[model samples]
Target: MKPLKTIIVMLLLLSISTYNCNAQDVKADVEKMHQLYIEMINNSNLENIDKLYTANASIRNSDATMINGLENIKNQYKATFDSGTFTISLETTDVSQLDDNHMFVSGTFVYSKTDEPKGVLKGEFVNTLKNVNGDWKILKSYRYLETTDNASIINSVYELFSKGDIPAVLALMDDEIVWNEAESNSLADGNPYIGPDAVLNGVFARIGERYKSFTLKDVKLHEMSNNQVLATLHYVLEMKNGKTYTIQAAHHWTLKDGKIVGFQQYADTKKLADSEKI
Candidate 1:
């Protein structure tokens, strides 16, 4: 028999060795699981869904909707594949063991349409995984899409406009958007354009026809409370009659769920009007 102190030391070393082996195993298993998910998404393999998630698993979608149960998760993935062919890549950032039978994983993912490789969306996901028998299955998952702050959203509108991407600008507006032009401004004739289509026709189209060039200059955006953004800028415009004008302008934008829901403009309308005269 070994001495008492030697026996104790051997037991301690064995325990540490066991723990280190388990840690390595869990890390490799996590990587393999994420790789499997990517393969399932890229291949649209519905048959393998059972191996990925538990029976009562739930998902909290980025849009704030909750999908419960494995059947719904399967259906959701099916719909995703039906919409378009997409390729997904997942990167596991952290994997922590919650116990001998559970794990917490956090990772980032990027998805791109197979046809449009340049258009990709990146997001983050947190997943709770349960070890059932000898397999790991996700129990609860939550995902968030890449988001822009209020000021950034408002700033992007200007950038997109500068690049002549009118459709992209309109895409950021809510379906029931309410737009208001400066009170004395000629475009205000159609005050409170009720929708994107209305604003496009009543304000944007009219401006295009009336001005040889209309551009915003020295623009600054301020993020305000209550989901509003304030933009202080100047307009550098040339009228069709060869008259040019520079005027100060301010825009107050209200957004909801990342979409522009309301807009108000404040500017020197007198100069805008005067510039129209030859």
Candidate 2:
């Protein structure tokens, strides 16, 4: 009886060891697939790109554009390589085993053109890979470019404003923009300021006339779903009476066609108004 019990214990240990070995093998295969993907991109060759994806794989571009199927994916790569010379570097940040035959990987990538040395673009991506037969291929790829794009547009607005380029800032807005100022704030008097002209005349002009210096500080932008962006910032308003007001503020913006179409402001109105006192 004691001999039989010892044999059973030995068998259990072997099974556990085998399971661990299989997990390690899966990890190595997944890592190899990622390396192959990077190699295909760096090579800038469409022929090798086809080998990295399944027949029905889908890819989402940074600007929220979707490419479906292997043929279209090949075309996208062909267009990119044909456009100009660029090199991409990807660093894996996280990897998760979804199942015995699937994996999820996310990482940041940096891309730069050989000619445009100063024009480097960095973006993030998430990919899902499936084990087909004995090899792994990308099943779905989502690139987080919308975040960068929306942040860029918002930053440009602030830059233009700082440079006193009101016209340029207005140009970035839609023809029929819906701009809402914080409730109870002086600017809110013209709530839902429609159009670029209305925004310039109602909001900007009023602020210029009221405050000696109106500046935004510590600004942060967050990208949300459905083409929305949220900005958290602080307002530093210097009154003509030698008084100053610092108030927390937030701005919500909705954009389309590379133009801002909607804006909503949130701020401490009472704090801003009190600064007007001598």
Candidate 3:
């Protein structure tokens, strides 16, 4: 009985030690994977990228497109590298360990070329890592374009406005613009002012004609939960007829290809009408 008890004690200790060793191995593997990413980036090692990605790896973008297979992944990076000397900085976040073999990580990739003079190519990305046969591999990845956080589009528009750069401001508006003035009316003549020329000549120019100069004051951005942004602003306008009026407005804007494409304007229609009553 004493010998049997000794054997059981030995077995328990061995089991406990194995469990602890495995736990440490997992932590080490995570660190190793991160280091490998850094090494690959620093070397621009397009050749060894297959070692880091799975055979059937997939990359989905925030724009809702997917890239599949190792070749595609390699090609993607190759093109980017070929285009310019890519300087990429990666940050990992939301690293949730799904299991012993699966993990999810998300972060931003601040990309800049050694040649481009403008600001950096800023964006965010998310990745799913899976451990297969003792090696961690990127099973899936997703990337998205980063845009202005606090209605910077509107700010850009206002900058052009201050300069009285009408063409620059008009270029930001869509082909179809919603004036949002008529009561419950959605017609081109009523709610919307259709076509670029109509907006340029009819709306913006008319506003300009009324004002010798206008200055937007107290611009505020209100972002809705649905990703819609309202840029609320007030401005004082000195009329060509020597009249000054305070106008409050809301510019509802939507973005596409990093530019404003769809727009809705809400403001005091009476003030606009009163000024334009020729």
Which candidate has the highest lDDT of all? 1
| Candidate 1, backbone clash total | 0
**Candidates in descending TM-score order:** 1, 3, 2
**Per-residue alpha-carbon lDDT of candidate 2 for residues 1-278, written as tens digits (9 for 90 to 100):** 57998999999999999988886887787678767767777777666766689999999987679999999999998888887787887878887888877889888888766665544567788999888887888999998742447778988898889888998899888769999998988778888999999999999998899889999889999988877899999999888877788999999999874679999999888897777555
Range of the 10 consecutive residues with the lowest summed lDDT in candidate 1: 112-121
Candidate no. 2 TM-score: 0.52
Question: Against the true structure, candidate 3 has what lDDT?
Answer: 0.70
Shift of residue 272 alpha carbon in model 3, Å: 8.7
Residue-level lDDT of model 1, residues 1-278, one tens digit each, is 89999999999999999999998999999888888898898998887789999999999997779999999999999998987788989988998999989999999998877864434667899999999888999999998977658788899899998887888888788769999999988889898899889999998888888889888899999999978999999999987776678999999999865779999999998887887665
Q: For each candidate, what is the lDDT?
A: 0.88, 0.84, 0.70
The candidate scoring highest on TM-score is 1
* Superposition error at 112 for model 2 (Å): 2.7
Cα miss at 47, model 1 (Å)?
A: 3.4
Estimate the lDDT of model 2: 0.84
Compose the digit string of candidate 3's lDDT tens values, residues 31-136: 5766676666656778668778999999886556788999998887788677666566777655667888888877777765565433355778778888889788
Error of 2 at 212 (Å): 26
Q: Judging by TM-score, tell me the better candidate of 1 and 3.
A: 1
